[model samples]
Target: MAKREVRETSELRAIVDSCQTVRVGAVDEEGMFIVPMSFGYDWELDESGTPRLTLWLHSAGAGRKAAAFGANGNAGVDVAIEMDCEDGVITGPYACSYSFAYRSIMGTGRIYPIASGEDKVYGLTRIMEHMAPGAPQALGPGVLDRTAVWRIDVARFTGKQRQPKA
Candidate 1:
């Protein structure tokens, strides 16, 4: 076993692209809250070569998620997200040696609502493109109004992998 510190931005992007779902975590009056749901993401390196990642998520306009993230409010709430692409099980002769192979990305950021109709459409389009490319991305009238679109501009992220032995 080796240390899990993935510093390469390309590798981190790959890990994110390989998965369709992300687990988002936040805290509210009740305590810690988390949910696993499908998502869409974008990643790029800025002019200074700093990595930038953005995630798009959608849910009902009102719920626990919205409450935890202050979706209906002006203030942004801190959140953590995680996604993983599982490879397979790594079998071993002994129990201690057994492990699963996977690549994962974990990040922290603030989540805010996409207030404008144009921005909501954009976020929904990205999600559709990532979840099912070539599918019709056009939104019907008032669809954006009924759905809650959220954006997460990942401040920092890291990737890790445990590859199976050859």
Candidate 2:
């Protein structure tokens, strides 16, 4: 419901920035699959300073994810940051109260494999920075050759939070 929705752009960005991993959803010949993956992202700005979010991910050159991309480039992604939880509190005599507090962002986007060496390196660098800040920025050509980098240009997204009812 709207009461649970997070409408501020800054808040949504915070949720994304706080999370280290994203759940990527895609469909294949067999069926659908949702997998957790490490990711890096960039928030690009337009002339008016509006922000555009794009996610970067990496994987082996060949595999189920690669195959799924080949079949369908469309995908959905979710990033969640759990803030806290409450448990074992008896709200009623008959049952214990349980609730989780978390902030999350989810959206649909088109995934594409980055083919240009320079672009791939840039994306990979962002990924490394997010996963391991202060780590090496340089990625060897051999390593790049063995890795497949992908980008998701998010078209639409929404943020939501569930908190303990006051």
Candidate 3:
């Protein structure tokens, strides 16, 4: 079994879409911290029509994760993100021949808090759409104020996977 790199943008997006959570990693005065959170994603086209990926995350209004995201400042913090879907294991004649099948996307980006109320609503909407599609998509009063919404503009990302032998 061998690991293969998924180089196409569509393929990378597919991998991300298949995953439920994203692990965000950051560093603070104490040390490095990583947390897994529910996420939503979107893709935009640049001037050259290249696809750009942005991830949305939410949490309580106050916490270590919010601080690491530069909640109080306009400047954002650097973050590393990873998301994967386990595809199950493959059995072979011998232990050495077995391999796991999975697809993963890993990247680094800048995470910033969405300060505006409207933008926070937008982020929350995306998250709800992804996590609970077909459910009520309405936001009640004070929901935006109580929740912390974050936007991660992916600078660069790559996808990789190992497949079970046929």
Candidate 4:
């Protein structure tokens, strides 16, 4: 498979940027890869290093995701966020498809379950922020207790982008 070039610093960060929600792919012991769900980028970068993606994952309390993770601790993940370009365009009819179609993102990271209480709380907060951009959302009481947070330390991330001429 060919790799895409990484440009525009913001593109690199934009993948996990203000945009929330990402699909996580995990492999099962049966050698089957299953997409757990659509998680969002909870936290960005901190004093530690590269932005570690924060996710609010939910299992049936137990299911494919849980089993897959158990089989292989080191999981493979892929995320793609697509924006609507020219919806519909035609010539004679009256419309012509024309819009910008660009995507900047990369996949490949190590999954490390949040351990520290503070970090977990921080990550959870970030998740909420991503979900509700500028909305005011306060934790009810102990919302953290029921939720599980996973942090993906971006090992290798690269993306490519192209826009319509001005």
Number of the top lDDT candidate: 3
Worst 10 contiguous positions by lDDT, candidate 2: 79-88
Question: On residues 58-84, what C-alpha lDDT tens digit does candidate 1 reach at each position?
Answer: 998888887777643766888999999
lDDT tens per residue, model 2, 23-131: 8887777887876778899986678756688989899888888877655433432222122122223243444454456777878777788878888899999898888
Q: For residues 1-166, could you state the per-residue lDDT of candidate 4 as single tens digits? A: 2454655455566655533445555555566453534444644565855555445543332565554544333443432222212313322433454444455554666555554667667776666666666876566676556555666555555566545444
Worst 10 residues of 1 by lDDT: 66-75
Q: RMSD of candidate 3 to the true fold?
A: 2.2
Sliding window of 10 residues with minimal summed lDDT for model 3: 1-10
User: Against the unseen true structure, what C-alpha lDDT does each candidate score?
Assistant: 0.86, 0.74, 0.87, 0.51
The predictions' CA RMSDs to the true structure, in order, are: 1.8, 4.6, 2.2, 5.6
Backbone clash tally (model 2):
0
lDDT for model 4: 0.51
Candidate number of the best TM-score: 1
lDDT value, candidate 3, whole model: 0.87
Of 2 and 4, the candidate ahead on TM-score is 2
